[model samples]
Target: MTQPPLTTNQDLDSARLREAFGVFPSGVVAVAAIVDGAPIGLAASSFTSVSLEPPLVSFSIAATSKTWPTLRRCDHVGVTILREDHGEVCRQLAGPVDHRFDGLTCSVTGQGALTLDDGVAQFDCTIHEEVQAGDHVIVLLQLHAVAHAEASMPLIFHRSGFGRLSASA
Candidate 1:
């Protein structure tokens, strides 16, 4: 087989890169914690399992995110894998800072990690490490506890939109 020649294009920009990246589907998750007696969080589609033996998971957040700065200060953080029906909830989390958890039902741990009641999976974790990557920070979380609903489908992010996997798929 003949390999195609690779060409570098100077016109590649963030928008184009994002569009290209959007083709890969990813699961959505809500990373939250109780800060100063209030719930603080943000939705991220970059959540993924990193290692099984260490029970590690990772998510990437924009370096400029206002919520992450405060949320990271907590002793523990809760990560909830959003259910297929949580598209609206995901949007709300990404909206205004004060109104994020307005109508959502959530539970907070003694350590201040907060998890939505109806997520597909929930994990209580402590920050294991943080690595600076380009314009974002990759957060590695060490799980202390976890719960998941085996029958639930996760909300998916692809092509810059939210969706779900079909039963047959």
Candidate 2:
């Protein structure tokens, strides 16, 4: 019998590390940008509130994502907080589609960013900066205009499925 030698300090496997991160509950956000006058978007759970005073927010996209490169080049960006009904929207955006905006209810902001249909919350943002961090680009944005939905209960992602908010105990 033969055995392979182990490295002295091999750190945690990235796959396991990612799975560990999946344990955290995060809000589902759709990052939309207009390209050639059409809206393109990708679902992300990386969104975060950066500041309250200046009204800033942040989200990270993988540097290797082709879609991110295309969307990042646009001047206008919108972060739409997904509703429970948006699970399909998230899947569609992540899949291959001739047009991501197909059948999506949207209205352009004053700056021309596409706001999703009845999003829980839509943040019209200006790209402040994108800093390279590890394998992803942390997008820093300044909230230009904020719109809230007629109701609350923003969509959430957990353990690989869409989640609904449980009433506070």
RMSD list, candidates in order = 1.6, 5.1
Candidate 2 Cα deviation (angstroms), residue 40 = 1.3
**Model 1 segments more than 4 A misplaced:** 1-6
**After superposition, candidate 2 runs with Cα above 4 Å error:** 1-10
Clashing pairs in 2: none
Cα lDDT, all candidates: 0.95, 0.82
Candidate 1 lDDT by residue in tens digits, 67-87: 899999999999999999999
Model 1 TM-score on a 0 to 1 scale? 0.95
Q: Which predicted model would earn the best TM-score? A: 1
TM-score of each: 0.95, 0.88
